[model samples]
Target: MSRDTAGTAPASASAARTGTARTGTAWRRMRLWGLAHAVDDLYQGLVPAVVPYFVLDRGYGYVAASGLTLAATLGSSVPQPFIGLAVDRFALTRLAPAGVALAGLGLGLSGLVHPYPAVWLLVLLSGLGVAMFHPAAGKAAREAAGDSTAAMSVFAAGGSVGFFLAPVLATPVLVAWGVGATALFLPPALLMAFVLVRAGRRRAALAGAARPRTGTDRWAPFAVLTAVSVVRSVVFSGLSTFVELYWLRHLHASQLVGGTALACFLGGGVAGTLGGGRLADRFGLVRTVQLGTALTVPALLALRLTPGQLPPLLFALLAGAALNVPFAVLVKLGQDYLPTRPGTAAGVTLGLAVSVGGLVAPVFGLIAEHHGPQGVLSVLWAVPLLGVALGCFLVEPGPADQREPARTMDPAGRSR
Candidate 1:
């Protein structure tokens, strides 16, 4: 009996060790997934910052340039839901890297093309490539993260870092070597593709070995989350596209001052993305979201009323923080809603919902055009209010209220 007990003890310890190893491996994969997302976001951010310069230099007017920018955004945004659907049906690990490679090719090819129409067409194609990256990458992040809000926060921060880096890194390259050197990013893009492919293979191997139970019904809660995300995106769009111009034109801020203000906003977003995730984990998703959304009001009002540089600067910082904090929380909430369908939830929340803002950007532009840029802020002020109303309707998930379970069925009549 003593010998038999000792033998069983060894078996139990071996099993525990194996579990520990698997957990560590999964954690590593999650970090890799986040890094992959950051790389794609870096490339995405680079395009907008650099493309505008190229258009202007090539003799495109504000309208044409705006059209090109919108075209790229539409390219990136419109296909997300479809991509989300595709990820549900197909293997996404293979799709993401392929998309990144195509985007790299598109960017490189765009450099070879001239005429305005060709440029727009290439931008659209590049957008398609970008579209591929988000849903697939987001899905990977969710799968790798399991149910951890901290993991989601880390993943979301990768994109925020990418966004911050793009302008800072790409601007100098464009200034020094012109548009041609921007293609230098292609090699890094290819390298990222290679890394993701390897990671996918590793995940596949692990999945085969573990034979974890497959989950279902991940679509319902995403629809509501998508609506919430759209409101957030609108606010983001108002800030990203118009904030600098608004400050410069309305408040008589210099170009430098305007740019600084925008930087402050993005910096705040970086902080918010990481902090918001932690907040979500601690306070519950609904509370975290409400906190972020509620703060947007005062920030918006401050921007609207403030006169001096310091106050506006402070407002920009606070506004940026409020704007970005909910991004990861929403992604986590979506995952919670459809605990079984992490990728699908990520696709809807991160990919489709975020894109809606680009669709609505022109409306904000029109408002700015008519009422001055200040009107744009006034219009944007309504978004958070709407979000707050929506927040009231949001049903918190079980226990910690960290997860957002699916509340509806798909078009296929499958309950989520």
Candidate 2:
């Protein structure tokens, strides 16, 4: 070979090594962001897990428990879109730490507060903290993951792990010490909030975004996606809110059995969220979502109708996986559908839109009050089928999208 060719080969090899190093560094950062996401969401899961305690120990009525759920749900979700819009204009990266800390602190105070109204206020504060974290953290995770659905899956799985851990970990402390044990759950959030504060110092994907597109909003697809997401929130949130009660009253189960049931469902969700990303990457995002939605009906049916506790518990795992596999993919798809406003997209999909389910939760409270917890759970069997019909209306972005750049940032944002 010529001397020029030999020299060029070494130079190319060096460039490859440097590129690989940068990618590796980015991935490590992404994992850390995932850890932050998990800790932030831990407080969210804690709200539901602690609900049973309020009902059983404190002798709170279904309406009162539902009111607490509404406060937390609305607090965490309603402010998200506005926060996303604000962060898009100016990166309030610090909001993430503040949000997590607020979530932890408010929840910690709940057990200490005596008045019912004050306790409700504390839960709302915690939910606001959750709302604060997602828009900023999600944009960071999107950048750090660099459009790798598998990496996004890892990030999404973190939240699932948090939700799964909430019941498993909280059940013991809560059972032993009552709702006042909420104070002990503060440490992880406090510590992680500091972790996020430091991590936010890193340059995020929004830093290297492309210029904004002037194209019209893709409201058609977005509306469909929102509808589907709302369905998911209702079913999943309903389950989280009621599953422990369902086990205790319906199946005559023990506390350990109850927590384990929740864990099985959420554990399945973690796996599904991770695997769903790969499935989306491999089979196409829309197709994978279709399968997941279709399966949700059968799994939930079996879970609801199964005679024995072990059998129903096993079905909960299936139901969790079938329902949640599309979640991370749906988030990514929303970014694609509205490429110009990815922050708003992230906010709606992650926060406001998803919270709609929680809005309807009081209806379930009424059902539980009148028809009982079994009736409430049984009614949810119809929700997944609606998701399926909605899925049918969604049009994929197309095969050409696979080879295009994955980062959903604008050129103007990238310059920052």
Q: Name the lDDT of candidate 2.
A: 0.81
Angstrom error of the Cα, residue 399, model 1: value is: 4.9
Total clashes, candidate 1? 10
Root-mean-square deviation of Cα positions for candidate 1 versus the true structure, in angstroms:
8.7
Q: What is candidate 1's local distance difference test score?
A: 0.70
Residue 353, model 1: Cα distance from true site in angstroms: 0.7
TM-scores of the candidates in the order shown: 0.80, 0.88
Candidate 1 stretches with Cα past 4 Å from truth are: 1-29, 51-63, 107-113, 174-181, 210-220, 247-257, 308-311, 399-416
Estimate the Cα RMSD of every predicted model relative to the unseen true structure.
8.7, 6.3
The residue pairs in collision within model 1 are 217-416, 220-408, 221-406, 221-407, 336-403, 336-404, 336-405, 337-404, 337-405, 337-406
